[model samples]
Target: MPPKPSKPMMCNRKALPVAAKLKLIRKLEKGTSVAKLCEEYGVAQYCVNATASKSGKGLPRKHMKTARETGLDAAVLKWYVQERSVGINVHGVEIMSAANRLVHM
Candidate 1:
């Protein structure tokens, strides 16, 4: 098994930038899975969503016109679509809003 994450690793705030977070959320809106993002960056679900919420925008991978969109990679996008088509539903707005609320607490 992998080593347990240290406190710092568990609490990193530099996973992504404000603009990048916005891009990530928007990418998610186009059927991306939050779990993929969490695993990809070793970030908690709340972190991914809260960052996006603070940016006031969701990053839609489909809307991406270049290869520089951080964290919303092609493999992750494919997994996102596959997971979405398999009946797994992740309510984006509600999830993000709740994450935001929890972050502010």
Candidate 2:
């Protein structure tokens, strides 16, 4: 018997960016239909509804941490910029080494 070909899978999951969410909210305010918006954005109707309901709230910064961590982040960023400006190819291991050196200083 010959092998059968498998059917293609269709996945509809999507994560909309903040700007796109804001655009969807605006369109909703302008009386655009949810079905139409869903079709246009390739998102589910529930996503559009959720975006409309959560329009004005600010998105939290996932990378942000305490003051000490922020200071470390700034120091590492400065080191990275300096290294790059001097024609150095900064790799991940080198970055980690610089961060560790900065931490102990």
Candidate 3:
């Protein structure tokens, strides 16, 4: 039988960073054992699979998405990120306004 994780090992955490996930996946591709990787990285098997799946996406994954988050306009999110990269600090209200324009449905 698999050993039970300790109580401390069950502590809740934010989603692990993509870079860290990618690194773990890279190690796996290079022949590292999953059990050893999980132990070394303080993650579970679920995390390993999720990380691998998310690594190949064209978009970044958003963690803990709320029920109220359904109305997002992707173009606004993309433009917001691009503008931010060029040093623009956009507010939520601004994104909403822009989202309205981009969301034709």
lDDT at 87 for candidate 3?
98
Q: For each candidate, what TM-score against the reference?
A: 0.36, 0.42, 0.40
Q: After superposing candidate 3 on the true structure, give the runs of residues whose Cα lies further than 4 Å from its correct spot.
A: 1-8, 12-14, 56-105
lDDT of 1 by residue, 65-91 (tens): 675634445445555577689987757
lDDT of 1: 0.65
Note the Cα lDDT for every prediction shown.
Answer: 0.65, 0.80, 0.72
How far residue 44's Cα lies from its native spot in candidate 1, in Å, is 0.9
Q: Among all windows of ten consecutive residues in candidate 2, which has the lowest summed lDDT?
A: 56-65
Q: Alpha-carbon error at 19 in model 3, in Å?
A: 2.1
The best candidate in terms of lDDT: 2
RMSD of 2: 10.0
By lDDT, the candidates rank as 2, 3, 1
Task: Estimate, for each residue in 1-105, the C-alpha lDDT of model 3 and write its tens digit.
Answer: 999886555435536777887778898778887788877788786666667666663234556756444456456778898989999889989887887777654
Question: Model 2 shows how many backbone clashes?
Answer: 0
Model 2 Cα shift for residue 72 (angstroms): 51
Candidate 3 TM-score, true structure as reference:
0.40
TM-score of 2: 0.42
The runs of at least 3 residues in candidate 1 whose Cα sits more than 4 Å from the true structure, single-residue gaps closed, are 1-11, 56-105
Question: Which whole-number lDDT from 0 to 100 does residue 31 have in model 2?
Answer: 88
